[model samples]
Target: MSRGRGWAADDGSAVAEFVMVNGLLVILTLSVIQLGLVLFIRNTVVDAAAEGARFGALADNSATDGIARSVDLITTALGPGYATNVTASTGSYLGHPALTITVQTPLPLIGLIGLDNGLEVSGHAAIESLN
Candidate 1:
């Protein structure tokens, strides 16, 4: 009678294999979650910037109003943790008064495997100044 080379009728150690496989799966899952979170934050900031830019382009737009609108839009669009970093007058990009909205958010992870911080995104729109 003869058993397998690696299994001599007493080899049932799958713990190592299972651990490796499951560890890989866990890492993959974490990566996906992290990516999703980043994408979500990016989209939210984009939306906020768009909204703020839209408001800023209005005829009666003011510097205070621009900042307030940017903050409000960012807060409303992203719930919390989303901050309006800078809102500036872009002047005219294409023969029209332009306003810029910048948004930022902190990442959950750093060098581990995710974004660090100070991730800023901006949006610009033309002003329809009635004056």
Candidate 2:
């Protein structure tokens, strides 16, 4: 008599493998998106710093003006409340008048724990003294 009949071998087990691969792909895609956002914020902040430094390098530059310009540039480049606690100072670099601008902003991220320090951006440029 024939033993207990059993079904033939099947390849249906690939479904689980496919699902796992797709899940990994999805996670990778999200990670890429997050990295892009971080890069964007970094570039935007750098540009703002450069702009502020340039403005502060002008002939009629002052500490307040530098800070204001930095704030405006950062706010415009990023968005409202993006730049906060900005400080600008004047110093000498290579025996030339230099202006330094520092700015801080918070990064936008989901559950960005332990980031209470936020982000900081700064720029320094030689001031063109119109004497």
Q: Choose the strongest candidate by lDDT.
A: 2
Q: Which ten residues in a row have the lowest lDDT in candidate 1?
A: 108-117
Candidate 1, residue 65: CA error in Å? 1.7
Over all chains combined, what TM-score does candidate 1 have?
0.77
Clashing pairs in 2: none
RMSD of 2: 3.8
Question: Per-residue alpha-carbon lDDT of model 2 for 6-93, expressed as tens digits?
Answer: 5754456589889999999999998788778777877887777778888878887666777778778778876766676777878876
lDDT of 1 by residue, 73-103 (tens): 6677665456636556667667766887766
TM-score against native, each model: 0.77, 0.79
RMSD vs true structure, all candidates: 3.4, 3.8
